[model samples]
Target chain A: MIAELLFAVFFGLLLLGIHRKVIARIQRRPGPPVWQEILHMLKFSFKTTWIPKTASAALFVGVVLVAIGIWSAALFVVISGGSLLVIFAIYMLHKIVEHGFGLSSGSPYGKFGGVRSVISAASEIPLLVSVAAIAIFTHSLLISDIVSYQEVHGPLLITIPLAAIAMYVVLISKMPFGPFSIVESKELVSGYKTEHFGVWRAGLEVCNGLKTYVLLLTFILVFIGSLPFWLTLLTMLILVITLSFVCALSPMLSPYDSVTVQTLLAGLMLVYVGVLGVMS
Target chain B: MKKKNALALTLVAAGSGVAAMALSMASILPGWAYAAVLVLAFPLFVLGLGLYWMAREGEEDIPFLGY
Candidate 1:
């Protein structure tokens, strides 16, 4: 557990490094230095933060803090051999609480962001269902048990291609690339995080990074199974590269369109899961 | 701005490096399960990077935008 937590911290910072790169690519102008994200975080952490006069300062901070807390709970679920259902519930609850924070901000941007979040949350249901199916099939919700199942039954992907596809869609939906990024639109003035600044923003950014690593770890551990220690780490590296290219090449889909795509993706995946279940 | 884009691209390239490592690991492990890890490993890593960068950008504060 300690090792995973440490990795999450390091991986989260590494993500900041990637952000500097991504922002550079999106805008035509030359960007900051390579290690700019780290610098930005350092600066933000030290800077003083102000609460909006009208804002419920406690709730504002509480929402983001709780967001981190919920994510940590989800990660702990994976580490401690808990029910996948519980993890899913915690993840969902976190989203809801975040939405409440956005709405409470009483900013137009925040309201739009909250609405976008609702859309995003709705799309997550199918992914959660697919995960449940995997648990049902493997007869356990524990990450290690699922890994063991893969070792004995072959990688779950080979047997359940649709489920794999669904999982990917879920993964994509969670992060919001291009069109799917309803709540996080670059054009929007801060989207859900419009009012936040300084350490609060930094905390949220770090947590977002941590969530990314945790989700990736979940997918890899569940579907990929146990690799030799060194090799397992290596495969993780490769997966990140492939995902980055996919992001670059794939045209950004609008959030509304992403919803349509996710729906279709989910339906197809459901059919595939049904078939797989019957076959096995 | 161009520099930022280049940096992002470069960091993504690093993600590829991680993927390569995963491939080699999958090869040494027992069975196709390991191979599957090799296959999905790089993409998952990229996904992580993508989510972090994309989501973090959402947190930027705009001056003219209503708080």
Candidate 2:
């Protein structure tokens, strides 16, 4: 478990670094070094951290801690081969963390981000529907069991391509770019994270890195089947690189448009799952 | 100054935390020790970073400037 956590943090940071590099290359501009994120984190540790005078101090700090804790627990679940149901639940709880971060701050931008997070919660239904489809096909909800089933029956991607596509959309939306990033849209000046700086912001960065690892790992386990640890990490890195290119090439969508697209994807996924459930 | 000392301490703590994590992952330590280090690593990193940030001199009145 310790090893898994360390791997997630170390490689997760590297993943973000690679993402930045990829985006920079796509834009034909010289980007920060691949180790830029690590340097950023180190520099942040030496900077000043302070609570906003106008904000709710307890909630502001609490949200950061909660974000870290949630991602840590999710990492543990993935590493320990825990139930998919619990993983899905943690994914939903993440919305609460996002909402709390925004609402705790007094800034109107933060409030807007919080409301957008609420709207984005609609994306969760598609994620849940994807999980349901996997459970039905695998005849189990435990991640280890699902992996074992995949080993015997081949990868789930071949069996249910629609669910894979739906999961991929969910994963891309969680990233910082593309049409789904309205919560932290640039117009809101970084949105919920506008006021977070120094160490608190550092904490958020670590949390995000871990969140990315957990979500990508989950996708691999369910769709690609289990592999050795190194292979799993390599596959995830490749996926992150691919997603970064997609992000760099796409434009940001309006908040309403993002919600509409995500909700429609979720609805389609749910209907597909319903059809499959009946057939099976 | 006091702030410099705090920042130094923060650096030591954060560096140690990262080292412990790496050592544990490499499996150089006993199981119990590895578990203990794992538990301490993240909190140590966060606390050290937060303290270093908080102990800086002067106030940040400008946007997007300062430490």
Candidate 3:
């Protein structure tokens, strides 16, 4: 378990680093090495730290803990092949983590970040549609069962392409600097994370690594079915690279534009789900 | 963030981490029991360790009042 958690922390950050490098290259600039995020996690952990005086002391610190905790639980759920709903629920809870990180700090930027996170809540509705589409096909919400269904019926990506696309959009939105990532837009000065420094920020980094790992792996397991261990790692690499390409080419949207885009996508997904539901 | 508080948090983190691993591996415990232990332990573990590391003595600048 320790080894698994460590892998999530290290390899997840490594993937993020690769993501940055890919984006930079696409934009014609050198970026940090693939190990930079891991180094960053360490660097933040060892820095001087303190709570902001204006902060709601308990909530300010509490959210960081919850951020890591929820993602860790998410990892376990994926590892155990538990209900997919649980993972989505945890992802929803992640919105609260973002909100808390911003509001509890008593900083205007952080508060705006928090508010944007909630507004961006629309971004996750397509994920719900995707999950519904999956359940419609498999007649089960359990990951283990879904994988078994895919094993017998071939990959869901081939069968329910729209759902796969919906889930992909979700993973994209979660990526840094993507069209919907306004909560952390530069105007917000790191957005929700502006106030969480030193060890606190390191903890948030740990959570993010685990989140990236779980979300990517879940997408693979659900849509592509399972693979051999090393193959699974390779698939994740390819998957993130694919996402990086999309992210690299796209410009960040204005917050309202982002919401319009997400809402429109969600509407399309809902239509797909509605059609799938009626057909099934 | 004091020394004594930091030490306590660290111990909680260490103990919780160990317990989570143990419960997951235990044949006698039900799966939900292990999950419950983990749900409880995880936040404590992350929070504890972060605070422990944050306990270093310093005369840092006041909180960001504004730019």
Candidate 4:
């Protein structure tokens, strides 16, 4: 099981590398190799590190532990086919981690990143709607039941693609360089991640890698149903490629614009859920 | 001393991982026991791995004495 955690972290890092590579390629620029993210993690790990002078000493350190802990918990939840609600809660907590990270640093840039993370909290609502849509259809919030449902009824993608779209939007919003990614935009000097250098940064990268894997896996299991291991990875790659295209081709939106887009998407998701509620 | 601290943490993390693995393979144990180990093991692994790397050789500074 611990081995599986390592696998998810490494594979997710590779996926993130793939995301960066694809985005760079789309703009006619040569990109780093697919393993760059893994190397990046290693590089960050070996650097001398200390808490920032102006930071809240305990929260700064505590938040990194929380980031890893929550994600690992999410991984276990996903793997055990546990409640989707728990995953949603963890996703929500991740936003708080971001908000906390910024304030912990007391850096202007970090604080702004944290505030933006809060403002962008609407991005998380679409995920709740996606979960709601899934619950409405399957009549159960457990992931195992949902996958079994796909087995019988075919993938949820065909029955209610709107939910999948909403979910994908949620995924896109969390990814780097996507339209709603204002928190980590270049100007913030790495956003909430600004002060978390060296081992702390490496830990964050591990969390990122795990998060990428868990979210992609959840999407596959929920919408596409189960497949062989290799095939599942291929599907994840395809999904990442699709997201990379969006991140690559589209310019990052301003915070207000990002919120507007999330709001519109959220409204649409709510309407779909409402319609489904009425129909069923 | 800092190096020893890093090594100790890493060893503890590795020990936890080993314990978790062994406990998982044991059919006699209840499922919750393995979960209990996981709750302890995962953070130790992450923190151990992190601090292990963060520790620098030959860079031990004088301890900051509160004025």
Candidate 5:
């Protein structure tokens, strides 16, 4: 437990550093310094807190903290042999709360962000279904148990290639990289975060990094079970590089297109997995 | 003059503390020892800050993340 907790935090920070570098490279700009995230957090800690005139102060604070807290808990649960149903429920609750907070802000961009968030949630359902299908195949949702199954039954990847694909689709949609970068759309003038500033902006940025680390960790566990730590780390690096390249090369697309492609691909994967389950 | 050095040292100490805590949590050390070391980690982190402060004559404009 101690090890897992420490590993989680360490990886989280390392990921923050890596993300800054990745984004910098992608934009062909010297992005924020590698340690910028930590420095920014320190700077934000000392800054004056600001509340928007049109927003609910209490709700705004709650929204920011809730997003951080929920995300933290979800990531923690991902490590412990927790129930999958519970994990899924918590993940959903986090999204719903995020949307509610956006709507509560009463800003036009917040409203737009809320709507975009809802659409993304709608698109994520098929991916969740794939999780359920995989759970059924292994007859367990505890990560440890699932990994053990792999030792005995073989890696889940070979059997559930389609589900693996589904997971990738879900990951991209959640991270919403490349073409699906609409949530962070500059044209929306920062979208949900337009009204947020100072420490609040800092919190959101950390949360963004946290979400990336947590989700990537999830992908690693699901797709590649217990390996040597170095190997796991290396695999993660490679995968992120590939995603970064894809993001750079691909043209940004409309949210509509994002939702469509993600849902269609995920749906296809789910069906294939379903058929595989029936056959085996 | 001393106060400024102390403040920078404190900030560095905090940064290192976070890093050490993270290491203790993630490392594959025996669980009980890991927990005990993590507790000790905080003070050692502070000591580190004190050392950094003593070494500095007086400096502001601390480098980002170097601490």
Candidate 6:
């Protein structure tokens, strides 16, 4: 378990590093080293961390703990062959953490980010729908069970393409770049994270990395089937690279626009799931 | 001395948590032990945060948003 946590933290940061490098290369520039994020995290940890006087002290710090806790739980669930339902619940709870982070800060930017997060919570439904679609096909919510099913019937990506597409949309939106990143948009001055600094910020960074690792791992487990540990790690790396390219080429959308597109995508997935339900 | 001790305890707790999980992954420890470590990890982390808060030199007077 400790090894898995280390792998998630280190590899997750590496993914962020690759993301930056990929984006830089796409724009015809040399990016920072892939280890830049790790350096940044270490730097943040060494800096002074303080709470804002005007903020709710308990919630301000509590949210960071919650963020770390949920992702850690999700990582454990995924690594230990736990239920998809539990993982999905953790994913939903993450929005609360983001909301708490924003609301606790008492900043206008944070409030805006918080509201946007609420709007984005709509994406959770489609994510649930995607999970339900898998459950329908596999007849189990257990990660191991789903992987086993895929081993016999081939990857769900081929069998249930719409569900895969829905999950892809969710993954894109959850990632830092892309249209759904209104929570931390530059115009909002880093949005929900505007007030966080030093150690608190470092905690958030680690949470982000864990989230990336867990989400990608969940994707592979559900859609790509399970592989040996090394192969799984390699697959995750490749997927991150592919996603980084997509993020680089895409343009950011307005909050309203992103919400609209995501909702439509979710609705489409639900329709597909419903059709599949009727057929099966 | 108290602050330093708290910091050390935080590190120790975190390290033990990681070590517990690692050992479990390697099958050297029982699965239940890993779960127990996992349960303990968050509180230890929170304790560290609390100690850090207590040890922090000063508080930011400025509001989160420059009002």
Question: Pick by lDDT: which candidate is best?
Answer: 3
List ranges where model 6 is wrong by over 4 Å: B8-12, B15-33, B46-56, B64-67
Best by DockQ: 3
TM-scores for every candidate against the unseen true structure: 0.73, 0.86, 0.94, 0.94, 0.73, 0.91
In angstroms, give how far residue A161 of model 6 lies from its true place: 1.5
Write one digit per residue (lDDT tens) for candidate 3, span B1-67.
7857866977876686677667667766666666666666766666566656654756644445457
TM-scores of chain B alone in all candidate structures, in the order given: 0.35, 0.52, 0.60, 0.62, 0.37, 0.64
lDDT of 2 by residue, B1-67 (tens): 2656756766775566567667767888654554445444554456555665554634533233213
In model 2 chain A, which range of ten residues has the least summed lDDT? A1-10
True contacts kept of 2: 0.18
Which is superior by lDDT, 2 or 5? 2
Per-residue lDDT value at A265 in model 2: 86
Task: Encode model 2's per-residue lDDT on A235-274: one tens digit a residue.
Answer: 9989999999989999988999888888888889989999
Candidate 6: residue A193 lDDT (0-100):
85
Among residues 3 or more apart in sequence or in different chains, the pairs in candidate 6 whose N, CA or C atoms overlap within 3 Å are A1-B21, A1-B25, A2-B21, A2-B22
Task: Specify the CAPRI tier of model 1.
Answer: incorrect
Error of 4 at A104 (Å): 0.6
Give one clash count per candidate, in the order shown: 34, 3, 0, 0, 3, 4
On lDDT, the stronger of 3 and 5 is: 3
Give the better candidate number (2 or 5) by DockQ.
Answer: 2
Off by over 4 Å in 2: B1-45, B52-67
lDDT of 3 by residue, A9-56 (tens): 789999999999999999999988988999998888777788877889
lDDT of 2 at A258: 87
In model 6, what lDDT does residue A66 have?
78
Q: In candidate 4, which residue pairs clash?
A: none
